[model samples]
Target: DNIRLSIFVPIRDGLCNWKLQMVCKTDNIPDKERTAVFELNEGVLGYTFLKTRKHQIEFIDVSNNNNLPSTYVSLNSDNSNLINRDIKGVLVVSAFQNGSVAGLLAIDTENVSDLSKMEDNKLHSDALDWIIARSKAVKWIWRIKNNV
Candidate 1:
């Protein structure tokens, strides 16, 4: 069985602070089919494939409401008849508020017989890159504004 990984990045501001959200997902199907398995609650949302052999998918949302984090939700289950019996999909929903994001990540694990091969370092590195890029871009914008 093989799975795919994906990462989503979102940028927004609320009140006086900037917020960034990154969602990661893993699955063994196409994005269109994968999307039909999960739902998002607020802000902006999107998905993409990141890798194979343990698919990962991500949903990201950004907002200004400090209390929005409590409203985040996720639901996941396996559909054996949809595809190969060994292929499974996972859904993750995350919310951010007051410069923070919180949410749930769920996986359809009926088909997965083992969890000993999962590696998440790449995902962390990708997230780090996203934050660094955003920081640099924001700083550049501020520099330009101060000069003007």
Candidate 2:
């Protein structure tokens, strides 16, 4: 089992202020078939996460977190129902560097207990640091390719 790390950058397209353009993901998918992009609407999880620009965790229990927009509650795919049966929720974290948000990292877990236990563990910190570093690298690559 592998965790998927998605890198999103804010792009403007007329009225869309904070449109999250998916630059890359750690998942092994064909380039021509990847379409995991979304807009960071106000009060949604992506907006909230991007605003904080800090490492945080979210237990995405759609049944309980109705306040979260449908788009914010799921990450497995554009379709929320595609969530894995064993995935009780997801633990998402973000990275920021050079005074700007870089990207988001998410991991699927079997239950809340698994994620809760990771809060203060060394493994969690190490993994988070690695993910942040990778995200920064991906952002750099994206900027170079797009001449941003």
Candidate 3:
């Protein structure tokens, strides 16, 4: 299993737009970092909610800064980046109900090479597909739990 952590971000209607509240993180994440509140169209979380995209998630590993795209990267300051350096692969998908997005589901890994397993056509890993499939369940849980 290449997955080190999986997180569910519930999208709620804010004053102007939607808000991406990060929660339901696996044990690996520090409790302090797990309660972050992110806005729509902020870093990787933003890309998943783009209007032009479909209900699919792709595995992306950009541990190397050189390979990371400028669009996906977020800066808190001129020199600070939000994404952790230890993170490797990441995939995100939006969960929907009645054609409205309800939540976001994401999976990530610390092993950079493990993410490339499916890439190399060497190992059979459904981790990416699994996250996409489980997205529906994520939405179901969020709706019931948060009464959204």
Best by TM-score: 3
Cα lDDT tens digits, model 1, 36-109, are 32333332222322111122334322212342235444223432233234333333332222342322233332
- Residue 45 C-alpha lDDT in model 2: 40
lDDT of 2 by residue, 1-148 (tens): 3344445555555663555555665554335323444556422346446455466544354324554545553443442333234554455566666666555555544555555543445645765777676765856755664457
lDDT of 3 by residue, 19-124 (tens): 6666677766656555455656555565566542545454456576576555664534421233455767666666666665666666677786676653443221
User: Taking the candidates one at a time, how many backbone clashes does each contain?
Assistant: 20, 0, 0
Ten-residue segment with the worst summed lDDT in candidate 2?
Answer: 76-85
Model 2 misplaced regions, further than 4 Å: 14-16, 26-33, 42-50, 54-63, 66-87, 110-113, 116-123, 142-146
Candidate 3, overall lDDT? 0.57
Q: Candidate 3: where is the Cα deviation over 4 Å?
A: 73-83, 118-137, 144-147
Question: Clashes in candidate 3: how many?
Answer: 0
TM agreement with the true structure for every prediction: 0.27, 0.58, 0.68
Off by over 4 Å in 1: 9-28, 34-98, 102-114, 119-148
